[model samples]
Target: MTPSNILSVEAYFDLICPWCLIGKRHLETAIDLLARERPDVTVQLEWRSYPLIPATPPDGIPYRDFYVARLGSPQAVAVRQAQVIAAAREAGLTLALDRIETFPNTMLAHRLVRFVRTQDGAAAAATLVDNLFTRYFMRGANIGDGHVLREALAECGIQSPLEQGASVQHDMDWLPPLNGPDDPPPRAGLGVPHFIFNGTHSVSGSRPPEALLEAMLRALARAKQIATRAVA
Candidate 1:
């Protein structure tokens, strides 16, 4: 319940996760729909960082091997890869899994996002985020690499030095929704594409844009009810 009836939508995710990228697209589409359908509703979007693998070195680990260990076998990895590729296509995203040879730590990437979001604005942060996803997932660039991040920042019109943002900490403690109750219940996990709408509604994983739009509507309705109660 913001002063100006601003609706808050937070996407909790890690950059290295492919599913998160798909989820991001769905959220973005939902944002567009919300803007067109309900122009009266003001929304605030935040991209919160949640590193999936904190143990991986900044240099990154072998891409194939990392999944092979996590998923159990090469065949399993192939199956998952195919599944992700299919899902990505449906979302209008082309993922070059073959180009991704290494899985680098995304701590610094998260830090950069934090800096850009706080210093610049949500739109600027989103452009940088989208650029990073395109570079790493589409072109197979190493997002964990400092040079790669610098290039991404430059492409997104961020002239800040990469050296200024170098924190790689992983903090995944659960807290209430972004715009929900006065006291939010704690929740924790490593799920990407997790969306919390107005702290009143939350949907996890890479769902369809329609589903996200429904959640947004529910959140807005809830906000209206809350505001009504506040005035009464």
Candidate 2:
């Protein structure tokens, strides 16, 4: 398939996951590199919903407890988090892991993303997700808080209360469930930052830039083929 015939790529992710932010940066860098190599290929990016730790309480869990419970020991958790931070840096993302105070439920954030999609489609959603990640992971802001989430949406040019209202109304229908009878079971119950490319290719975790670049290129090719067949 030719570059010109390639359609957009949809990325499913959540803001709270550190790996998701790293993966996002890698994908963006890959897209930039691809653009330089193949100037004619226009890849529109679409951000979809995939919440991590969806059943988290609204008030948020203590970061230390959460990490220790997941990683066994406080020291081990710190080491693991440090590894993620180093990886994020290598991916050109500055993550201030020390500043994160709370691990709030991301349901509201996901809902807000759905709301943005209605107004500006996927582009706005992408912007919002990027901002939220930067704010939460890099700057160590409380993304679980309604005020912070609202402000982040506003930064992306969305009206706060109105958008929130719309999101609340359509949250169940628009946003994908984390886990329930209605939710589609993830591929092997994958974690956050899981990416399904063109509904065929699956990539999980914070992959390197080169790997994501290859995935995107492959997804683009598959998309082009499907589009051409449809037209034919």
Candidate 3:
């Protein structure tokens, strides 16, 4: 397989978002399908940090109350959660939304991902990402807490002390600053759980595995075309 056969999938997500977890599941399934169908193609998955609710306090706030306030009422929150739950269920994942207490400030969590990626490698960082998501969404753990983050890091076989302070912020230097209230929205203005294929095709939101798979295939084709053009 040539370099052109490698498909890069960049996923922008926030750990606190249930949809990001569901999106991760879909992306995984899509990769599996691509592997089965295109044995010669290699998919490189990169997870980017996109904090959906950056304004949340460093210590975080009550999860239920946060949603209730944002969505207007308890009934509205329930309806929205139910919709997300149904989507997650379809993806073969379960989200314990009701059990979550803190909405959490995900800066530390995202920085931890970058730290693990730098020290251990992308694969280790991916494992840590999965662990963090599970801890928060499934186990209702507060990922914002340094203690919880350290535990999650240890679970991923990372024994080094958790990086903190100004250094943690520097870990995110590779990407642009998080969107501010006044800044124009991100690509497509679709927010977290956004997927970019080979930096060419982008799909926003938690789309189905099939749709993601299609995007991967299209990206691979475009890569091949570009490679051919270069040779010509």
Candidate 4:
């Protein structure tokens, strides 16, 4: 058995992305598997905000129409959504895309998550994340609505004073623009459901649980090597 070590993981996601929810499920499974295989290793996970389309209006646009236009036609949209549904099913998720009516601007939602993390904790924020995804995809709630967000926050037991606003206004202070020229390739054009292990190894897209577990092992091994070299 290896000596104890802590593995840090950062997950960048957008609330509106179905794959983000699916990827989150896989990551949880991977974490559980890692705990069984390497009891000596502890995982520290943090969720980061990455809005796919920041330009989306606060009120949002018609969800089905948005996809139809983006994917060229309703048939193409159907095909793409079908693929998403199949992938989600594999992760034990059932996404009701038909229930969704509006494609919301996720900026407010992400800001609220940060706020919750600050006021409560990571676990509380995580619960809010799950609630937000479920509300939008499963119940077809327009998450961009302040009322909707407040309802989710209440469900998470977050009693922050910001509850009245339903939106947190940190002004994107923590994160830099995704398209910054200084960023590297994948970082610049990174897709949602991206994960970084130990701040070095990265896995993009909604990969399988096995793949995530392998990445965690690799990150742990690298951390061990660095510690060994430091002692030497």
Which candidate gets the maximum lDDT versus the true structure?
A: 4
Q: Write one digit per residue (lDDT tens) for candidate 2, span 147-216.
A: 6876787788865455646444333464444444532455556576766666657677778768877876
Given candidate 3, what's the lDDT at residue 215? 90
Q: Which 10 successive residues of model 4 have the least lDDT summed?
A: 175-184
Task: For candidate 2, give the lDDT of residue 200.
Answer: 58
Off by over 4 Å in 2: 1-4, 163-188, 223-232
Q: Which ten-residue region of model 3 has the weakest summed lDDT?
A: 175-184
TM-score of 1: 0.86
Off by over 4 Å in 4: 1-4, 164-186
Question: Candidate 2, TM-score vs. the true structure?
Answer: 0.82
Q: Name the candidate that leads on TM-score.
A: 4
Point out the worst 10-residue segment of candidate 2 by lDDT: 175-184
Candidate 1, residue 136: how far the Cα is off, in Å: 0.8
Of candidates 3 and 1, the better by TM-score: 3
lDDT (Cα) of model 3:
0.82
Q: Can you give the lDDT of residue 183 in candidate 4?
A: 26
TM-score of 3: 0.88
Q: Tell how far residue 218 is off in model 1, in angstroms.
A: 0.7
